[model samples]
Target: MSYLKFDKDLMINLEYSLYRNILRTNRKGAYQNTSISGCNTSKYQGLLVMPVPFLDDDNHLILSSIDETVIQHGAQFNLGIHKYNDDNYSPKGHKYIREYNIDSVPKTIYRVGGVILSKEIMFSSKENRLMIRYKLMDAHSPTTMRFKPCMAFRNISQLTRQNDQVDRSYREVENGISTSMYYGYPEFFMQFNKRVDFMYQPYWNQGVEYIQDMQNGDTFKEDLYVPGYFEMPIAKGEEVIFSAGDILVNTSALTDEFNAELKKRTPRSSFYNCLKNSAHQFYYIPKTDEMYLLAGYPWFKVRARDQFVSLPGCTLSVGRPDDFTKIMDSAIPHIQDFLNDKPRKNIIKQIDDPDVLLWVTWALQQYWKENKPVFKEKYVDFLFSIIDFILSNKHPNLTVDPENGLVSTYGRDVAVSWMNAVQNGKPVTPRSGYLVEFNALWHNALKFAEEVAAATNKEVLATTYEEKALKAQQSFIETFLNDAGYLYDYVDGTYADRNVRPNMIFAVSMDYSPLDRRQKKLVIDFVTKELLTPVGIRSLSPKGYNYRPRYAGTSEEKEYAYFNGCAFPWLIGAYIEAYLKVFSMSGLSLADRVMIELEDQMQNDCIGTLSEFYDSSPPFYAHGGYSFAMSVSETLRAKRLIRSFG
Candidate 1:
């Protein structure tokens, strides 16, 4: 009865099947991703991609993939596919695939000769462990299953080459073998529930080309070090569970542990539940004592803006106050960095984004609205500190314009807000001064902070923030509105970006909307006429001069097209909020249609989860990161909003 399944017709069609992928996460920052047919089509695709604590705290593909073959009556059927150099797919294991289903776990059934085998893949919730259960449903005779374990032991973002430094030797444990290619890498342990004999033959799987990487202008071909195969006798009705982890484990208890972890999962009956379940995949508790979110699967790390933007939907909407509190508490320090504009390393330096602070305040406001706290002294002080930082305008790159009370990027070369798509060290969309969404969130933050301050009995702070918010509102309404009925996307000196974009939707979507009912209707109508798409709202309306309909080609080309016209599924949530705000419950029909459109996308790139973006043109092909946290979380939020209206 599961709707998420692919039959042999589609499974055997590489043109269609190769584009479709599957992802499994451990909720602790580790994940497994590959093509639906178990082919490694992308460098980010792997059987075991986990964060290695000892090796600089980045996700590494310790195990690239494992291929399974069935030996019955001396005939072998390889149920594994790999793309070699020059775009050659060896063994062509997908040809034997009968069915593939992604319900709870990714299950693939293969029919070879008279033997039918089913493989189910699952990951442990709290640990870096992956379990693959193989069941022989129907077979004419006993079958010998051989598994070849391919180990990369390199960063997921990088590729590996065949080298003599790789250690071929492996230590045999109680019911498994532990292997590591080099020093500083976590030793990977592969074990099985049933007794099996491991062959000592080791070889290099060279020229394994990740097609998607080549298309992205990255190192596509990699050399995988695969130690010998494990041969086990499996009869009809017999099941075998294969487990892999960073540390040694008791093989016998893996099944029971996996089952117990399964018991902890919420039931996924609807598309909303599916998205809600995937939202948990992004939740990570690293060395930081508080919970954080990884932006996306198989690649991205924790980002300040992404975490804050996704927090309310991923946690608060699910009625998880404890998770919300942990996430907010952990994120406060990062938001402070944005306010302070303190220098940091690579990605953290991006905290200077004016929108990060806005998102943080908005998240806190949403949290406070849901559960009115009795003024926790520490949290209240934190709120006051944020207000002080924003009003002081001490940051080097960001400043609050005293005249307008609007926040803007101080430097000329800086891309402060989320429309940040940089190429060759220059912003694709140079939205430097007073971005539409930034000022909208800015107004909302100040208003929310004023309320917070008043609730905490700090009357002076409340009055100051109230005055500042009103000033910003006055300037925003006077300066940003255009004759076209939509607010300008950004205003930097005399150059005002008068593009139709989803950024203006936040003006009316937030709780303390700065726009009046009439203006809200104008903005909503403008967006609906131009920016709205089936998947989400486009970054720039096609009617604009700068709109890019497609997101494709080289890294530089894609980066240029990133925010220029790419459609973000997360923005759909704001569009829904704006629709409901402008038309009240009467807008439920349109909002429901938007939500349903996004729901259909759960079956696309990453099954049961939404992608980060899509093309702005017809069909709106999903692109960017697969299993994006914001996409999943915001979809859940939009669904909740529509249901509430109903």
Candidate 2:
């Protein structure tokens, strides 16, 4: 009945279920990620991954996993699955799973002979906590439930091994206990809504293997500490809730708190709604006054370019304009510090990336198209300043060519652009010159700022901006456009790199393009032929020299595939926009087909959300980050554009 339901056949098949994972976030950096079979297949897969700001910038796996054991008449069935050495599974409990779905929260139903129990997991919306509600749906006899938590108090990226360094100590708190494995880390608290008996039998779960990490050429084995287990009795139709977090809570009010959090969640009932739900998870609000857009889950962080690129769709298109403003306003100080050549004192990384500041203006452009008055009132000055700063050659890596007004990268690193995958300290895709997309964005930013300045009665500034835009527009067409009608990827002075990449699509997609209608149509057609995949737009054409057909194999192979030919869903926004721009209503068929093909993605990869990138070819298996902000945001934007055809 649920949209994302997995039945007994699929649940029992480890090959099908173990690779597919589910993710839940608190929007304050804490999250729950694990395989559908309740197996911890990745080091990043945890029951309670919390952000310990005092310790470091990365999210820590405080509660690696919690195994649930259902006991009846002196017999116990552990409804938990863990991979060990030689690919062996311990307490292989996935076979007991009758169904697994995420209609509201992720719920896994298990039937063990005479007892049928359901486990529902949810992360608190505002706190660093993971709550799992266990209900004995139907029981022939009295059932006792035992919870054994696997603790690994280490950064999510790192694997832990058994060491005497762990304190291995605990203290009572509320209806449960709390303990910290390390000195600098916060103590983890585990409690239940009802009174339970705690059995302090410490054990080590040695060499637990992560299949995904093993495939990706990482340290796939780890030792998880099992401090003890909690035993409690359950009756028919009775529900008991378990909580694991960084702080103690009022056990009595946990039921109400769980319900409260549930009400705030958007049900993943349909494709758009599932995206809306996943999109909301990327929001990181450390405090009520401060906010940031996390780039992706299980890894990544508050990246500057990602924040701006993800802002409008994740916030504005989702009808959270208030949140849009909240995030944009929070970025003001960082923008100021970057432009002024001051110390970069912010959590948002890559502020020095040449294209990061330009993307900020593009985000403004997207918002401006929807709400003009608010754009003028709230963001005009910010746009004007940033554009002026770029034009002045004050950006650390960017400068305007005095002769043509086209902004060029001066001393920028090769990996600074979005094709940022590096191997052996060198870029796989060295785009270190006048990038076509950067100039397209530069020209768009110039024109948008000029329009705002003119409207605001800043006549002198408007004239200056317009003059520069006109020069850039003329030079862009002359320098980037080739005899084949498509644009070059980048121009290193006299040498124009004629690689058929997705970067040229921006020329047709942007609000203000230097290309004429015919030129735009040609570029769009070229992109449709070379870069367009069934899933999205590929980073490079399949015919390119280093083009990779898939996003699979070892870590090194994936790094080679990262920007070589991997299709990025984020570029779908621009491709769809360009298609609609050139073909108008006539483009609806392809647009609908693209969206339909993408709809199937929700069932694969990470379940309800889009992955960071897909294989450039058929049966496009998702790769890179599990839940990417740009992927969700831009796909939402494309959907909004398609709906506008009505």
Candidate 3:
């Protein structure tokens, strides 16, 4: 685990109750001109944006450009919340108005740019009301954009209520309902005199002319009114009017000024800088409850929990016991279903897949091994639960082929694992049969289960898992090993796929009894020659038919080409581990040199920040961010692996 200079007070404040919203507005032709609206109560923050829409020559709008903008804008809104909203507060009510201003304002003192903009306005609090005014100084044509606001709430009191009602049955009363007022476009403005039902729409597909309803006493509502309007050719030195009006009835106590004062007390410490320089490559956002891997570039994004490949180096080497606990707690609940007799599908599904399961088990085992002092009875129980889950749900029908214990995964119809992809609703890579890497992962998982069971004094469970692990190892070796001594990527009798992929590295890296010295050397040589790149390791060898340089094209082309030849920086951990294993066995001087080269390579490619993947071509570019955790974690692990050599 990595050590970070985290402020306890700041961390606590981040966990406080808050809601936020932002509104960004920009013109059609001039993309540079932009305005933002920021709104929040003491409990929440909200955001919305009006972006420059890219148009074609014929005056017809390009759907692709619109889609891209929406995705990018939406992603930015999500990132802002993930980055800033320390306190999670859910928004209540149906009518929401967010405004932005670019011109100078009386109360506006701080400005990120020349634009003194009011970021957001929310209609959640009964006593507190937020209002933002904006004046666009210059733009080609006025353009307006709407945003779907996401709200998070503090449920401390609700938890107490839930606990109290756990044993007793009581009637819950719902009160304090607020209704949203609807207005028709630039021509007509229609305000709803009475509450009406509002239809919830997807974030991306939100357009004008949508109806919504108000819910009584609920902190969250699906459909909320956040509308925008922009008139083009406003001419130079002109302004646009934007503001939100709040209507509060039957509430005597009003505290808008007090709430504003409360918001002002929020700490503005630059924690991002600390995170950037920290030994750990990634940081977890407590409010959005997601992890971010600094993938060098600003644009790359990824899911948090998929960093199993980077965990050892990211958390363990940095000595972040707290992070380790968070990782375990966060992931265990989602993965618990897989541990039971009836396998529970995770949010992403495919939790039963060996690779994911093995990765989780590996992380837990390493955590226990490194932080034994912090290993309490609860930790042991958690580990045992995972072990029991894996043991009980052994797919009897889903056996490895007698010829090769490889598992199969395939196309759209059958969901094999998290890496599952379908093109046009058809499975892109079918592996419904035995796949080599799956078995390799399974073998390692069983070994880890056995180790955990033994360590926790579950002797009978340990013995059973050990027997299963042994059988798996035997089956894997017999089926996957080729005449050349290197493991085959996959095999189905005569139809054998002898690809030099990185999946085989896990077999030697995680297994208790890895490949023999000669076999290890051979595997390393093959991988280095075929899959290794200056930035990292390629998913497939360049010599293969599927190989394509890592460059953006159409969506289908990009996806197909990416895995075929794209260099995944995360795989460096496995490669480094495998190299160390080989060096330990052979007493090679090249091991130290390789370690130095690897570190230099990572730093050079990522510019001090590890990335998800690098281009498998000249002047390789890094892509994605969330996966950076793996790269950072692995680099840290590689340092430890080198230290072990010393």
Candidate 4:
């Protein structure tokens, strides 16, 4: 498959200023201007406005600039004129200019200037004009932008209808004139109602309010301005200045017209430039060849450790070998720590965190799979040390019941995996007994270690892990399997939770010993019957008591409910793998059919793309959309699974 196909004629020009503000403009009367400003309680962020022109005649046009500004801090900064465009533009003749003063005041000022960025635009063939989009970041903080707007039109015909006819709706309205606002000073208002939603992080300390009014009719008008700050501490020779002339445009007409205008404008490959730029932004460029390191989300920075966990299949398996090397090299220090019995915690602290360990181990295995020469010469010792640590440290507190092979995590306030939840400074899933998925991962880890040891001629270590793997396998079958042939959710002697969830799929799909044909069929049956959704796999079966349909509440309540019933698209990749494995084992056609169904479902339900998650209810609502790097990467992986079966 060709991964680098570029539409050369697409003239979607996007540029960013020194202040990191964006400007986009196209030939089809579509333009977007955005910036970042303010600090403290009055700080706010979002697109200033999107201009859509209505043509009265070929010579005369009616253009409207829908300007929007967000306040970040609560009543800290006051309104000012800032600057005006007339100072730079000298109109030829018969040109009209008007400036409707916007109110910028104490309510919008804050300590940190609101940061607003723009997404790459794909011109619409149907819209004749361009459609633009903008977002309000970090809205749930102590103070947020109030979204003051002003409509500026020059050389325009008068509007026949009143201001109410303009269709000015707020907070997710597509083409209407309605005004809705959020109440907190620093809260977010999501765009594209169907695709994304916001979840407040536990650390944020702010509120938000969204306001809009269509009171002015045709000429030009300004809404109330709330003041805020965009404060960044500068070093000794540091200074910041603002420029006001860049414009962003993405229109189908412009993209189509680019082919004719290409030679006249610049002598360069626009398509190649776009791809190169995208590749650079999506993954770190130059340093890592094919490895796509995620720059955390828009609000966060690129984390080295998180990238290592997702690098193997997410980057290497997708054909970026250069990126693979960079990721491995970057992770060597942390990899050595895992080998030396000092595994790193979530941050930089040297404490044994199992999820990080699992990620490091997985990366090592993938590196070995791709490049054997480096594996033997450089990684052999590192691999063994990781294996030794897992075998020795992981099982110390884990107690295996005499009758069953179930291993329970026993330690003070330790939740082992990434699902580790701390509520009010207390560990929530402090499960002292057998947890289902953790052991499944443990079993796979041991089996992988055994393979690596045997390959490296370390028979003594290989035999030890092999024995442990067999014992765990035997115990897993005995304790977890019920009369129905499907596995129990978790086991603690008298307590065996029988929830039908997606966690069990890992055991069936991983490199551990395979389940019996009947057991595999039963697992597929249970999962397909209860957990599948249109966009992805549900975290838990709806029939389970703890399942909740909606995922909205206070921070504490939402955090507690995150795992109970939320649907995750990444898990669907696992389901596809598990289904294929079961089909191969049982010689069943149902699993193959479901794989096809899932692929079609993903494309249609998720805005012609995939996302991090979706609502679990029917016609599953797409959430956390917008180029979720993992969602696209995993869907590509799942596509490979179907192809391999074929």
Q: Report RMSD (Å) for each prediction in the order shown.
A: 2.0, 1.3, 15.9, 17.7
Query: What stretches of model 2 exceed 4 Å from their correct place?
Result: 411-413
lDDT of 3 at 516: 68
Question: Worst 10-residue stretch by lDDT in candidate 2?
Answer: 407-416
Q: After superposition, how far is residue 497 of candidate 1 from its true place, in Å?
A: 1.6
TM-scores for every candidate against the unseen true structure: 0.96, 0.98, 0.54, 0.55
Q: Once superposed on the true structure, which residue ranges of model 3 sit more than 4 Å away at CA?
A: 1-305, 338-354, 394-421, 492-494, 585-608, 625-627
Residue-by-residue lDDT tens digits, candidate 3, 1-646: 1111112232223221111111111111100000111112211112211111122111110110110001121221111212212222222111111221111111221121222222222222221123232333433433232223221111111101111111111111111222222121111111121221222332321111101001112232222222221112222343222221123332222134323433532121222222223333234332345333322222222232355555666667766667767656665665665444455432323445455665666777677777765764547677666555445445432443334333444422653543344567755554444566567676676777777678778899889878777776777777778997778776654566776677777766664643567877888888888887766788788888877767466668665665667887667667777887766735335545544544443223222345567778877765543225566566566656766767
lDDT of each: 0.82, 0.89, 0.43, 0.43
**What is the per-residue lDDT of model 2 for residues 1-646, given as tens digits with 9 covering 90 to 100?**
8888999999999998998999999879889999999898888998999888888888899998889899999998998889998889998999999999898899999999989999999998878989999889999998899999999999998988999898989999889999999999987889999999999999899989999889878889999999999999999999899989887899999899888888888888999999999989999997789899999987988999999999988987789988888998888888888888788766898888999988999988887877888887888878878887887788768888899888788433468688888888888778867899999999998898888888888999999989989999999998998999999999986878878999999989998989999999999888888888877899999889999979777778889989999999999999999899889999999999999888888878688999999898887888889999999999999999999996
Question: By TM-score, how accurate is candidate 2?
Answer: 0.98
Error in Å for residue 448 of model 3? 2.7
Q: Pick the TM-score winner.
A: 2
Q: Best-fitting candidate, measured by lDDT?
A: 2
Least accurate 10 contiguous residues by lDDT in model 1: 341-350
Candidate 2 clash pair list: none
- lDDT tens readout by residue for model 4, 1-646: 1221112121111111102222222222222322211110011112222122232211111112222223344443322112113322111100110111111100111112443222122222212222332323223344332222222221222222222323222332221122222221111122221221222111111122111101111122222222111222222222111111112222223434322332322111232222122222335332222223552222212344345444654555556665667656655665565555474533223224544555566667667767877678877776667656555554345444444444566533765544455677666544446666667766777788888789888899889878887888877787677887677766655778787767777667665643676787788688778887755677778988878655556556555655666676666656777777766635335545544544443223211234446668865654432224455544555655666666
Better model by TM-score: candidate 3 vs candidate 4: 4
- The Cα RMSD in angstroms, rounded to one decimal, for candidate 2 relative to the true structure is 1.3
